[model samples]
Target: MFGRPTDIDCDLWRTDGALLIENAISSDELAGLREAFSRCAEQAKPDWLSGVRAGTRPAAFFDLPDPMGLDDRFLEIVDHPSFYGHLMAFSEGQVIFLSPQFRTVPAAPLSYVGWHYDVHRESTPLHMIGADLSG
Candidate 1:
């Protein structure tokens, strides 16, 4: 089991467009996720992921788009009880899982993503669930 979201978390999501649920998953689950993530990265094409290139922002890191097909563990995260309820609360029951991307920043002197919204075609809503795989 994982941590549940409080009213404050939901409010942050609704107002600030993002929410961070601390200790949402157990350490074991987190370890499993990290392993799965590494496996997925290993299977990726060499050119699929690249460091920031000329004309790109300092934080411009490419993503391994749609990694769910690469591993079943990713699918488990979709409906995982830990943060699923939070998603439901934030979206008011409008839970639609669209893009699942895995992004990583390379070792650099500076790394920072400018403030911006992740917009999809047709102006789709974003309910991003991010994990810090820096460990």
Candidate 2:
């Protein structure tokens, strides 16, 4: 559905506000996302990317040998016009970047991850309900 704002009498930005949903992206946009991810992988240097150690559940990290280089792609995704718009909409206009991490799930015997919240332990209580613009 189109998410274009209408002349409706509602303020969805208030705390505990109800959201007006919309299907923003088309199937083509979904495909583009998949392609971009694949291209990123293809362009990445195998040796520069390494797996993370197994965690309590299952997890592995990609050690971008060059943070600067890998960061370019990460920034691309975060700043991409279309992609960023979609992300902001889904997050209800609340999203911020604290840090970035890359992880890869290789074949069996290597891929594993546990369910966990991304919030920092120290920031608990003030639970990350909405995005915090500052890092």
Candidate 3:
């Protein structure tokens, strides 16, 4: 399956240039993906570094770059058929990996970036575009 994504026949690509396939990730693969995400944030394990020293859910980081590089499981998610298969289709066999990888955790919260724009006029709307690559 890694060789290349087999071409799709629908002519939607001729006009819309996009296609959405629900249930893309197989349940089995999804289980593995969940495992990978759970392991991705190894730092979640408390090491008494934060000021709280010993609190619930310590040192969990999010929006991390290249999290797939942290472990093979994460990397495997990147290689999973569910993710790359559709990517290959959308890219027409010439995908440009602009944003290779990133991840976010629930506890990080939105406030970090929530008031960022309003605080300074110099700030502008920021959007990060990338493939989930989470098989």
Please report the candidate that would top lDDT against the real structure.
1
lDDT of 3 by residue, 22-91 (tens): 6766787768777666665456433324433545322343444466566676566665675576666656
Candidate 2 lDDT over 43-127, as tens digits, reads 7544333332223233343433333354344455555554455446556689787545454556555243333366544454222
Q: List where candidate 3 sits over 4 angstroms from the true fold.
A: 2-18, 44-61, 83-85, 105-135
Candidate topping TM-score = 1
Model 1 gets an lDDT of 0.66
> Which residues of candidate 1, in runs, are more than 4 Å off?
1-20, 45-60, 109-135
In angstroms, the error of model 1 at 41 is 0.7
Summarize candidate 1's per-residue lDDT along 1-135 as a digit string, tens digits.
544678788678779977766676789887998998887777653545333333433334556657888778788878888788777766778988767777775656433344336564444233233346668
Ranking of all candidate structures by their lDDT, best first: 1, 3, 2
Per-prediction TM-score to the true structure, in the order listed = 0.61, 0.37, 0.48
